[model samples]
Target chain A: MWDYSETVKEHFFNPRNAGAVADANAIGEVGSLSCGDALRLTLKVDPATDTIQAAGFQTFGCGSAIASSSALTELIKGMTLDQALHVSNQDIADFLEGLPPEKMHCSVMGREALQAAVANYRGEVWQDDHEEGALVCKCFAVDAVLIEETIRANGLSSVEAVTHYTKAGGGCSACHEGIEEILTRVLAEQGKTFDPAAAPPPADKSGSAGARLGTLARIRRIEHAIEAIRPNLQRDHGDVELVDIDGKNVFVNMTGACAGCQMATTTLEGIQQRIVEDLGEFVRVLPAQAMPQTTNNQ
Target chain B: MTQAPAGIYLDNNATTMVAPEVVEAMLPYFTEQFGNPSSMHQFGDRVGRALKTARQQVQALLGAALDSEIVFTSCGTESDATAILSALKAQPERREIITTVVEHPAVLSLCEHLEKEGYTVHYLRVDRKGRLDMQQYLDALSSKVAIVSVMWANNETGTLFPVEEMAELARSAGVMFHTDAVQVVGKIPIDLKRSAIDMLSLSGHKLHAPKGIGVLYLRRGTRFRPLLRGGHQERGRRAGTENSASIVALGKACELALAHMDAEKTQVRMLRDRLERGILAQVPNAFVTGDPSNRLPNTCNIAFEYIEGEAILLLLNKAGIAASSGSACTSGSLEPSHVMRAMDIPFTAAHGTTRFSLSRYNTVADIDRVIAAVPPIVAQLRRLSPYWDASAGAPLAEPETAFQPAYA
Candidate 1:
């Protein structure tokens, strides 16, 4: 239930191109049964035109992964090999409308398998043994190229946005600084300027009439509570994030550790209430129910 | 919601409703006999005797030498943790531990934690049908290995492990062995005296008893340390106020298990087999998980490959069938089951895995209702699936040749 876009759901539920080609020139297989996802691609190429005449795939994965594979297949079907080669993981993500942050790897897997398949067809070796580029995210096997491409395609303007696309800053957050560097480099290459002085000031700090002192204090108090509770939440398979502070109504979104928890409402009432109460009665603590639902399974 | 006359209670592996007999046995301890077992009054003595009797019942079920060896714990998790911590503590110098990868989280998560603590942990891989590699297990065990913990039967697959062989190997290595018998305790015959297992854990709710009560058996003369440290409850092993009511219920559950085991196993096995065969014949790509010959009599793990397990479970729940998905735990991590991953089952298959564990109460009519209702559900989910194109194959598509890329 990761709030998959309508398009993503459409492709996932009734996917296009989900079978094997009868006569195919090149095929690529990536991922493993251990990795919890696997993609097998078959392509029938018109060698004279160097264009794919037919394409099909079978994916052994979840809804998102399967959708990514289906999208990848549809994108490249009946296209020239060169055109197919330009189809990036970002294109896959975009075609599906958007994927959940963690699930960008599913699109990445689709892209990698495609690239590998093309490489296999051409009998060409990859120029760089880029394995030594440094491990960015060990859990998901994400690397520098994946992050750079994700940042460029998604228009990731911040460290947090980069995390949303490539999951580079998601796990452990040990590599946040490294991901920031990569993001900076990608943005710079795209001629997007980043200036500390030019950065917009915090909207809350603008001291608008809508911004109440109680709300600001409650927000800060909730932030401290979230930070304190973060580790325990991670252990319990969930996480929390501050969504918004509209006057005295403090809104927070719960994910990972809190999602699907029977005690989620209790956690909000008990813990969030204490923070708001300490801030003052002018503040009202509320879970951000209006936010897009991101439950793991719908 | 309109309630349907207390719907037929199957799915015992998920959890069993507390038995009325067990409830009757527990009623006195809740009110009249409310004194702490440690109190000096005769009221305390009465509750203390209840605890002792419960311990003896559990011990008798396992065929252990003494009731002193059984430790009453809060739940299966605590019992598992106690056994593992004690084993690791006793052999501080030995850093390696061997265990099956298909164990429940109660054991597997502890192994993961121990691994993070710099202990060398070997996960014994299983076959597609979820049978452990005995040769790999023997090869993994050594003088460096302190303990080997495996489940008596898999919760997801219901595949019975070769515990007797595993215990023998551990015994020969002079390493302590523990088995989380939560799923297998009442369903399968377990004789601690005959087997080389040093420790075992069982939960009360998995059987016909109440929750919040569990038994952890330690072989006599085993070098073990207590996990909890406080008052002299549980013979200084688990030092918490005894849940006297639940303990009495658990004892009654044990007696029921012993009396009904034979008839229950035979009847439930037949129903389970009928359910399995009906599904396989009716639904495309529907197959049972684990070694069919070595599975529990009252459980069936079926994978209807294109659909998600949660979706199917939801559909089943709507149809008044209480089934479980190994993929969807109480915690909302939608990752395919670790148990299925350990068995090297493909994620598509793993995502589709659904467990239906039966009990003595389930009947052939219940199985028939499931069989009648399930095919349509599977078909509906498949219609939503990108993978289940009928043109692909009627049944038994070649796995290797099945990966067709739809890309140009």
Candidate 2:
């Protein structure tokens, strides 16, 4: 399940300024039904004062997307067109506390939709739809120009990050090489080196994002695994005690029948499997005797 | 330390709640019985005996002739990888594979990886009803095809494939065949003894067992190679120490499934039908996906027009209803489900598809709550949808079926 922020859930459940502005003159739309997410932003602008009077939005997307759209409307309601134009996708994200990296595209869509709405009010052509880059991701119909622009804007360095920002290379994986080339070119222009390994390859969202799990969550996961495994050891009149975690290696003390058991290696491996498989951590289960210096270390 | 209680869970196809019986059966292994089944000591002997019984239980569930046919693995993906890779290794002379376009990621991702390694894979497409084109399957089978790995039932649509017929054809073509029967094993009965399927994969979690336990049923005398080659476990068919607790849980889960199979076909089906009928009646422009006559009794996939699936699911979540979506946004992908795409389901309808999969644990009140919850959720999302208006009557699907090219 997505760890949607409470504010996001709040805005999604009880959105502010939903539906169209009753007397709105300008409307902007982004995304297609085929894209699986779209937003239409309507604004009621004051012609004489040029200050924004009201903003409303209708969104067709996930909870975060709806929340982002709602946040976009709320933020731009009292701001001038120029000020609203300055509201970035990150600002919308910050407004909602945060969005999952994979769902950053939702905020991007909100920003684009807002910009398009502002441009429509000025009777100016929308720049977002006028880009002429070749299609980079056939799955999402994302274009090369957009991918390169998003990479430069977000300072993205990896295909996975590019996917988060631009929805490029998120499907079929046929466009990952293209995304990598774009990332390399953009990062080189900014004089920053692009290391593919720095952000890992494209994986399912949970595995890729789990790389950032906090130490508390990580230890809790270890405890949960041990809790599941300790029952058997306890039933056998044995137990495994967690001693210390030194980076990737976890030290544990085996007591009772497990201390001198012939299959202690196998039992440790079993515990390791439980921790490493779904927990998305690079961890090793080692005997406390394997590393005796942890007690003396800070 | 506490939060909202888990709501009415309808995402059983994604993963079922582990049965209490399965939990009770496996708990002893975690505490007092954590012995390596391979040990020569009394502890090992006792574990090994329990493991043998678990194997027999799984064998009985599938109605297989011998218990030795079942090889335990970590999950359905591992079993799938093992079966497909083994087929290729055992017949290195053959470099081609045939599978459906709508297989679970376990099979589809592996096939896509194999394609990068210069192996040819024929991804057969399904019709509008999520039925595979038999002619395509027959045409794909040849001397060069090492294996035909089609899922017995699609996870998204719950459409059953003609695996028995496909397996027979592959056998006559001198090719191995495997089926990812993860969704079919417990929802429906399987008599492997009467079929020619060379290998089959089933996940424990889908059938009320905990995750991380699965079985690959390789027909006796079939040439095979181990995916994890190290230990003498699983008769050397798979390597690594046995996940004894989960393996035992899978055994008890299978036993319970065998006992409840009839109820799944009858009572569960009735609940699913009522839920479907109720929602369709209350909601406008809603259409059920997949074949009506032939599908898993527990699955009901409905598309609410003019609204996105994730938005509907979010509203349902607020109503304490748990369901899954085929929408691209829900999957963290750019395209909707490959199953929906392959079936030429239009983009307008495809992105709105929501799946409700039940288990025997569900009750009439659970269905009633869902039926009561969904129409309002759909109405709420449709009200928020840009394309939807209160006065609008219905919506039409996009005409283009060319985006996801059909298997020609």
Candidate 3:
């Protein structure tokens, strides 16, 4: 159901270097169980060479999170602390072919853990945890500084994208407005414009995500409605054939018993009503002969 | 195009495999008996009788006074919509609806819509064991309440609610009562004629029948309004052509369920308990959710601490096992299930909740396979869990762990 990559499944099923380094010099942890993902990275450093001698990770998360952590470990096994810090979330995802866009946060967690470990190795305290910036996503305990950094680093322009990258707006969504404000402020500072329409709102009770469909989607939905209604129409020894669609008008041809029958109007009306209900009330249905020019284009 | 994957399915709460008998009973209707039940011919007459028989079978299963009480619909959601909306329509002056916070989305989503439409909905909370507090439920009921729609059993935790008693209370208060019995009908006995429940909704697939066929049981004397008002289908209650084949399948499935009710309770319950106990014994920091003493016979919701559920399910899938999880990550959301949250389950343990729902089709060997496969998977995930410090035998590596609130 998740469309997880085979490589992700592979690493999750057989995770390498899974567990904490017993006596590691540096340990970095990020995320929490409440956020649906958490990761801890333990790095053993060869101080003379300034290289990561070994890396072990513990991840409490979904398959993608585990896979990303495994990939992070594999990527930074022999790299120096600075080199390991340069391993982006993208690198972890690239190691596993790719992760679903919604699961990108897992890779971000892996990269954050690596950075925290590197910061710890250098005797530098990670700047988060005590930031005075107000908390935005209370569900995930994500505060303003981290959200700003993630938005700026990823050039995130939408709340959904921010959630995917930071696991911030993914819970409760009470902080959606807060996330929007942060996005707008961060994008403005970077001289980039934020588009509010890029991400759609939550689906209504009808389960329809978008209020209106594009031209292609409208045509597809109309065709699907016709497909569903065709079999029932055949039971009455009649059939409806699509001729062409122009603007909001759907042109069709009625065949067999429906062609010149007294009930032809009723049959046409049924088709028109069904199309309108599925597409929208603005849709108009008419006979192909009534609208000839659109037929030739088809 | 390919062979079906061989796996042990334990996701019955999500949906169950269509019973072979139901399939056998439905095959003819798809071919020769495929006539509109509204038609004026012999073909139509045959289908109409089949529809009547199907209604009768469902009526028998629910122990309703008459087959006329059963109104067939598209699915559980449709049945739920028809019931809740019908109640509100019947009592236009009543602006409040009483329901539990742990209801399936079918009811919860409707409540949300109703709330947007200027209706006050009381989402009664559940305790740590996912049980509704009776005192709180009683406090929520008032004359302004149009309908009290609580689930007979929770889908997530399989916790049984006191629906019969609750319905009686609602009846005394002059409020309509509906129960989404989707998770309970086939797994347990129901005698609606003896209960004060005004309406009940059930899905076909949950009872080993095909999907797309559901029933709304409205009592004979109940005031109601139709949700769909087109054709004179289901006595003009629901509109649309009858899913004749599925209706027949549901009837046969109900008959089969009635025949196997004892085994479902005894053998399936035994298997479920064994699996739950086995997993708890083998895996540390794991505990069952809901009232362990009063839950559905064939369902178990277990939370494995430190490790997340999706990772465990993935490994289980690799081991040819099928299950579901309550984790937000599993659903592609950021928060765990509302049911778990309502019960105040710790965010740490909630993320790792897995639901293994059994059906009558499962065997002892299947139960054994799950028991044998779960420990290793838990161990593997725990190994990769930052919270799980095996040497300490407790959750570790946290400055927040000290502040983490304990929840049963």
Q: Write out the backbone clash pairs for model 3.
A: none
Give all TM-scores, in the order shown: 0.64, 0.77, 0.76
Two-way TM-score contest, 1 vs 2, winner? 2
lDDT (0 to 1) per candidate: 0.75, 0.83, 0.84
- Scored against the native two-chain complex, candidate 2 gets a DockQ of 0.21
Clashing pairs in 2: A231-B30, A231-B31, A232-B30, A232-B31, A235-B31, A235-B32, A236-B31, A236-B32
Question: DockQ for each of the predicted structures, in order?
Answer: 0.08, 0.21, 0.24
Give model 3's DockQ, 2 decimals. Answer: 0.24
Q: Tens-digit lDDT track for model 2 on B233-286?
A: 999999899999999999999999999999989999999999999999999888
Where model 3 places Cα greater than 4 Å from the true spot, the runs are: A128-298, B1-5, B391-408
List where candidate 2 sits over 4 angstroms from the true fold: A129-298, B1-6, B391-408
Error of 2 at B139 (Å): 1.1
For model 3, residues B1-408, the per-residue Cα lDDT tens digits are: 111287899999999999998999999999999899999999999999998898889998999999999999889999999999998998899999999899999999889978968999998988899888899888989999999999999998999999999999999998999999999998999999999999999999999999888999999989989998899988888888889999999999998898899998899999998899888888878899988889899999999877788887888888889999998777766678988899998877898899999998899899998999999888777767777776776667672463231111
